[model samples]
Target chain A: MLMNDKVPLIREKALWMRRTAFTMVHRAQLGHPGGDFSAMDILATLYFGVLNFDAKRPDWPDRDRFVMSKGHATGALYSALCAAGYFPEDWLQTYMQPKSLLNGHPNRNYLPGVETNTGPLGHGFPVATGIAIAGQLTGATYRTFVLTGDGEQQEGSNWEAAMVAGHRKLSHLTLIIDRNRLQQGAGTEETSGLDPLDDKYRAFGFDVVEVDGHDHAALLAVLGAAPASKPRCVIANTTKGKGVSFMENVASWHHGVPNAAQYDQAMKELV
Target chain B: MATVTPTAAGLQDCRNAWVATLEQLAEADPRIVAVVNDSVGSSKLNSFQKKFADRLINVGIAEQVMVGVGAGLANGGRIPFVSAASCFITGRALEQVKADLAYANFNVKLVGQSSGVAYGELGATHHSIEDFAWLRPLTNLTVIVPADAWETAEAVKWAAQHDGPVYLRLSRMPVPDLDIPNRTFRPGKAEVVREGSDIAIIACGTTVHLAADAAEVLQAEGIHARVLNFSTINPLDEAALHRAAATGAIVTVEEASIRGGLGGAVAEFTSANQPVPVERVGFPGFLPTGSTDWLFQEYGLSPEGIAAAAHRALKRKA
Candidate 1:
């Protein structure tokens, strides 16, 4: 129950999540491994130790909601969901197949844990804000969480939702920006400098917190705190491919699958 | 083609009917809520907002957020009616509509006000002439363009209980109410206003009244043209369309572009099922500076223009 005592369990869950995600992507032959790796630890912490959810009753009205805004990292979220007993772990082997429920992105219609259908960038944040607003309206005691890619911050709609969230002072909402530095092609700084990300969020009435994305203890500590009266934003600083030795901080690995030799080496490194 | 004079002036803005019906539904069901993009005045939701201020969510000019929030509210077991200008709501937030409401199948009603050149003097930027074409292609979205105030009220009531995504296109333009005798609004059913065998005159939205007037002109010319009011553009009443095609000629009119609207829909349906001589009456392209009436007349959406198109279709039939 205590945050400190849960670190080792969460770390083990995070490793399993990374391994499952990598294996799914490798078998499916199409995925964003770098972003998935960067976001896995956060997903593990939330599903395992931070959030209140019932996998058996995914539609429980009082259950907390999570939206994976960086939808390309579906592998990581799927891994976490499987670990949390949302679905059969055997289903992960059929990901991205012809008729699999595990689509390239999250689809709420097909999967129960997916709160909303989100693949297009900058969409999940506003939807999460709306969910938070609903919680406020009905006096429901449930929190809403959303994760977005660093490159996805360039969309103007995110700011639009941010303005509404700030104006409404939706304290039940939490937004996590996967600040892994590398986008698909180049670094985010080289493309669209987001150096003052914290100031921008703060100006928009968010309680901004920066944490090491790979550190389960730090993530649990920051993400567990409640907002005073405004929405919360967690800037998770991370390496693109955190666990793999060759792929860490590499831009090409954003969506690239590893070869057989490289895959074996990466699996060894993960262990 | 002889021109017939326009009808007398007993008209009501459809937005009033929409707001009245919405308030009634919200009163009965606590789950119904209204979401707007700073469009309370334009959408005529002031009275409803006053009645249930807590349920009225004003997202302040952000169309994307407005729609996204509607989906979220629906996820929370609240039925949200999202109201905004047609041009901005459908054009700016089309992806959100496609993904959040349609694909996700959320119980959200999208009310597009001032549709189909209703904001006539505001120029092409304000024209929602492309809404039908844009929304019809997306799956799982029921597209309804109510012809008058009674139909608008009925459509809003129906959308409230439908339990799926709906796009209700309401107009600011005032037009005489066509007598829809058994006026229940169904998703894809066409109302036959008149019966004949010479030809069929199909119309919808702001142009249905014009089609009725055109039928009178054709009748005077000894051509008894049937008149059909097609309120639902998608999931089109193919049975009614095929029956109309049996008359050997059809004239379709609308307040939107000649392509991909009521005219295009009819043409596509008829060509695939029953090929008949078809002539489409609508705006060929963007309009110049003019009132809605002037634009309607200039772009062959008037009763006289519709009559002329009927003659052209008859000639092609011959």
Candidate 2:
């Protein structure tokens, strides 16, 4: 769990992420708010209390890596990076605008903290597995973390990467699944069932950890833990569109835009 | 049978040179690593695996992960050479190659072994004829098709030293080394094997030597044919192409499909910049069951066939 003094700070960061992300989505009118809200707290916890990174020295060889595998949730990732001081807060205003560095997906070249370009599902896990293998090969002390939507677990490429991470025994790797249960059109269960997700990962030789995704203290508790003998997989159970009451658990908000009234409601509820 | 007779050096597979150069590079730099998709034997990396056991990552028939791992290894400061069969490496994990390596601009080298019709009898699925077309659009990638073992070794050395993404398309088909006096590996530059005024015969990979032999055939017929070993496909040596275009007639040869290999690159360049009668010698599409020799002879990849194509282009020019 997070220290008593840091828990409040992390909680405050998470609230800011929700508000900022919602604002970006409202302005853009073309953002994945449902997925973004579900993943924001996890991003907040990692940037504020868990991950080891220097925005100034972003290319530091020994820096820990956090790959945002669920890339469409740029609202969450951009806000967290901005808060971490990777760039000025004003850059967040251009989120998804033409020629903005904050693309629909995260690009490592354009942005400082993005580990790799990931818009297509199932890409992040394999790239992150590769990063972990690099650490293992050189005996490097840096850790690699990747976050994928539970819905994205259906992509065959993820399983392919899981096997590599397992076969190589990449102990320094951690995979966090934002288990919000909803995909773009429908529930993950209705679309493609991933209920035995934890068991599948365990079968792939990852130590499984299930956590309440929105709870900053619980998130810190599991995310900040040391590496186990096997690679780690954290299934972060969360509600889709968690912060806004009207959008909560609604599938249409997967890429839904908010009108003026709804925007005001979301902004008020985000706090 | 290959058009060229056995030289004093004898027949040598390019994979041998690839592994040898990789071994040397690894010895010099600890950051050099090899990632494969259960292709250690096919890629001729058995010795590499033995020497750098911990560094050789075998992702067990997983091309997507193998490429992604290469990009990841580069991120960790290791220059990774990801090797596999040309067909699988380019087809199976194409998106991974595009996003992780090319689009992301990772410092990785992708070695495509047994390119073209090396697996001739194995049928169309095993042939990597479409690799050029598939990969050509990704401008970030450097596509190098080495002609012989000497060029193969040089290309590997160059890839290791260069700090960007590259695709080294190596053929398993044995080829005699080009008889150039002072050879230097200038990527994106065509090698002039023979000088002539009547026509220019452009070839890459296993067909370069055949183009030279075709030049000899044309020479005996009072048609002095210029032979260019056009190795790099992506960055079309436009300077050399301009010179070739000045000759008024050209014959482009390759072991790949005519749609997008060297033939396609030449056709695209000449049609727009310098309109000339260009004869493209390559496979039209899928091939019937045949050995590499029979396919080469049937598809005009042989010296006589290339010479005939050069004649046809000269006729069109007149």
In order, the interface RMSDs are 0.7, 0.7
Model 1: residues with Cα > 4 Å off, grouped in runs? B1-9
- Taking the tens digit of each residue's C-alpha lDDT, what string does model 2 give over A149-264? 99999999999999999988899999999999999999999988998998999999999999999888899889989888999999999999998998889999999989999999
- Chain B TM-score (each prediction, in order): 0.96, 0.97
Each prediction's DockQ? 0.82, 0.85
Compose the digit string of candidate 1's lDDT tens values, residues A1-271. 6787888989999999888998998898899999999999899989987889999999899999888989889989899989999999899998999999999998888887999898899899988988998999998989999999999998888999999999999999999999998889999999998889999999999999999998999999988886568999999999999999888999999999987888788889887
Q: State every prediction's TM-score relative to the real structure.
A: 0.97, 0.97
Tens-place lDDT per residue, model 1, B227-312, is 99899997789999988999999999888888888889998988888899999987776777777877888888888999999999
For model 2, what is the C-alpha lDDT against the true structure?
Answer: 0.91
Q: What DockQ would candidate 1 receive versus the native complex?
A: 0.82
> Residue-wise lDDT of candidate 2 within B1-53, one digit each (tens)?
21222334666778889999999999999999999989998888899989999
Model 2 spans > 4 angstroms off: B1-9
Q: Give the chain A TM-score for each candidate.
A: 0.98, 0.98
Candidate 1 Cα deviation (angstroms), residue B83: 0.4
